[model samples]
Target: MTGAADRVYAHLGKWAPLYVWLLVVLIALGRTFYLSVNVSNSLPGKLFLVHKGAMPQLGDMAAFRHAGGGGYEAGALFLKRVVGVSGSIVTAKDAGAGFRDYFVDGRFVGRAKPVSRSGEPLKPGPDGAIPPGHYYMAADHPDSFDSRYAAVGWVAQRQIVGKAYRIF
Candidate 1:
């Protein structure tokens, strides 16, 4: 009986480790980390790796869920830089012809457009100090539809999905 049990256990051991590893990878891909491809040229790089367990911080690329605006679908995952966190100041300056320059903590971040690529009208984002539990997301891309426009607005703390890294 012992010999028979040993044979069964050895047979199971050959495939059990592989099965455990596969399950771990599956769980990590969806809950712990994920890979996303950039369809827009917002902040450079074509591929991004996001760690869902990490907290977002100022100056880091963060992944968040879009609340739907400017032709974007609700719940869509977006990656942008955290330019202004809680208590940071946001200011806008005229850049001529209905365009505006956006600044965070006195540093110029982006220019807000008056219209979208499909000819839809666009509204500039708000100015003044950022509220708690919110962040101003943006980048140096002149055409990025980020927090520089009212369409995207300030990203709420609940909307943040993860911290992202541009992985090319």
Candidate 2:
């Protein structure tokens, strides 16, 4: 065993470039495979809640894709309910009107569209209709970003990366 180990070491020292090339090739292939799996599986990605982008935005359906950075290492994911879509009209005032009032198209629909909180009917005005392709998502928290922020208002369906099922 000692002799064999010595011979292997001698050969490796003489041909170091070959070993280096092999390592590089392996690394590249590994990275490629990982990326392919991620794209196909929609592998859960991590999102860092930036100070500005911490709050969820409108058009946010599921909570898979994140606004901030941190690729595939984040653990916490946020889930904001969908409130409105594209083309829909939002109104500033009506029933249950809060600080964030919206008007979709020309109608005054409730802010919460598809899903309602506590199984209660959404407020009348202070609402916004969703468009066909676009969605209006918002967090239960009033201060949350959801559709309210000028920066991340109304997320496009095309932009959505994936749907989140679990938090852990």
lDDT winner: 1
Per-residue lDDT of model 1, residues 1-168, tens digit only:
999999999987988999898678767687788877888888799888899867788899999999998899999999999999999999999999999998999999998878888899998989898999999999777788899888788999999989999888
- lDDT tens string, model 2, 25-64? 6576553321112222122433322222223344433543
lDDT (Cα atoms) of all candidates against the true structure: 0.89, 0.44
TM-score of predicted structure 1: 0.82
Count of steric clashes across candidates, in order: 0, 26
| Cand. 2 Cα-lDDT | 0.44
Candidate 1, poorest ten consecutive residues by summed lDDT? 22-31
For each candidate in turn, give its C-alpha RMSD to the true structure in angstroms: 9.4, 13.9
lDDT at position 147, candidate 2: 54
